[model samples]
Structures are given as C-alpha cells and as structure tokens.
Target: MTQKYRNYDPEFKLYVVKLMELDGHKMTDLSQKLDIPYGNLKRWKTEYRDQKKKEEKEAQNQLLTASEYKEMYEKEKKSNVELQEEVDILKKAMHIFNQEK
Candidate 1:
C-alpha cells in the first residue's frame, strides 16, 4: 500500500510558524499537534527568517541618505522658483499688451 502525501497552502504554513513563535511551542509538539512533519516545520521557519532578512536589506538599499534628500529638495525648490518667475513675467507682458490695445 502507498501512503498519500498532504499539501499545505502558504497561509497555513505562515499560521503554523506564527503559532510556534507566539505560543513558544516546540517543533515536536507542533508537528504532533498539527499532524505535520517536524522537518517541514523547521524548514518553513528557516525560509521565513531568510525572506524577512532579504526584505529588510532591500528596504535599506532603497532609502536615501540625509545629504541626498537635502540635495534633491534644493533642486526642486530652485526649479519651482524659476517657474514662478516665468509666470510673473508672462503676467506682466499680458498687462502691457492689454494697455496698448
């Protein structure tokens, strides 16, 4: 006779890992209680930890340093001032043209 294999969804795996973390349950205890293999539970926990570390590293890489943020702010402010000056000049030209008409 052949034994059937059971498949678990991602939510179930995450819930099992969280249970172990929040309840301070041992791998053997959870495996017996949940009817899952001990090795599978251990592997899921390891994979979850590695994934979190990778995400944190990516987030750190995407953040700008203080000097970079200041430089970007200055550039945007200068561009905005230039645009306002152009608008003021156009309004003055329109006023002069209207008076001469």
Candidate 2:
C-alpha cells in the first residue's frame, strides 16, 4: 500500500488543480506528479462547476420592486430613529433622577 502524506486542505487541493490547469499540464501527469487521486480531481472539478451554476442562478434571481424596497428601508430607518430617541429620553430621566440623590 502507498504511504499517505500529511492531510491537505480541500481549498488548497482545488487551488493546485487550478494552477495545474493554467500551467497547461496534463491531468494524468498532474495526478501522478502531485500524488493526488484522479477521482478527487474529477469530483472537485464537478463540485466547482455545480457551485458556479448555483451562484449564477442566485445572482439572476429577481430582486424586490424598487418601491417596495424603498418603503422597507424607510420603515427600518424610522424604527431605528424612534428607538434612539426613546433611549435618549430614558438617559435624561435617569440623569435628572440621579441629581436628586
């Protein structure tokens, strides 16, 4: 049985594959040279392809209507401002009450 080397990160393994591709090296030669299993390279390549497809689909998904988005943002801004004002009022009340001590 072939001896195993230290475990490498999956990300690093993928990076190795990318670099090998860019270098115009043959996959068979790389598999032999890098001591990585051919199956791992094929699986990683497939996973990368599928992930890219999913990302593209998500990016092309429809966004909310401009008016609806604007309305939601304004509501959130108003709520935040109201909360800040209430906090300021409570602080002032506490300061005044403390001064009577």
Candidate 3:
C-alpha cells in the first residue's frame, strides 16, 4: 500500500489557525475534531503568527518611508520659498541702485 499524503490549501490552514485563536480550541481536541495531525496544526499556528509579524513589520517600514519623504519635502518647500524671497529682495535692490545711478 502506498502512503498517501493530503495537501492543504492556504485558506484552510488560515481557517484552522483562526479557529484555534477565536474558539480557544486545544491542539489535541482540534487535531482530533478536524481530523488533522497535531504536528500540522502546531506548524500552521507558528507559520501564521510569523506571517502576521512579518506583515506588520513591512507596514511599519512603509509608513516610516512615507513620513521621511514628507518631512524632506516640507523642508525643501520651505527652503525654496525663502530663496525666492531673497531673490525678490535682491532684484528690488538692484533696480533702486540702477535708478540712483
């Protein structure tokens, strides 16, 4: 007899993890009730938690990048406005000196 293996989809694995979390289901009971191996359930739970942590970390990094870009943009905008004002002042001064000459 050939040993057959069952492949589970991502959705079903996620659902099992959610059931464990939401219902406070014990691993042994869940394994028996769901007709899944205890080791598979444990592995799935670990993978799910790790995946969530990774997603959270990625989100934080993206937010930090966006905020850094915004801060740099604000600084550049302020610097440009100040430089424009200086240029206007210099032009006026030059005009007045030419009129005096």
Candidate ranking (TM-score, best to worst):
1, 3, 2
Question: What does candidate 1's lDDT look like per residue over 1-101, in tens digits?
Answer: 99878899999999998888777889999999989999899999998889889999999999999999999999999999999999999999999999998
In candidate 1, position 18 carries an lDDT of: 84
Instruction: State the lDDT of candidate 2 residue by residue for 20-52, as single tens digits.
Output: 556767667877888888777777667767887
TM-score of each: 0.67, 0.55, 0.62
RMSD of each candidate relative to the true structure: 4.4, 5.7, 9.0
lDDT leaderboard ranking? 1, 3, 2
Compose the digit string of candidate 3's lDDT tens values, residues 1-101: 99668999999998989989888889899899988999999999999899999999989877757788899999999999999999999999999999998
CA-lDDT, candidates in order: 0.93, 0.81, 0.92
Residue ranges of candidate 2 with Cα displaced over 4 Å: 1-26, 34-43, 59-64
Candidate 2 at residue 62, lDDT? 56
Candidate 2 local distance difference test against the native: 0.81
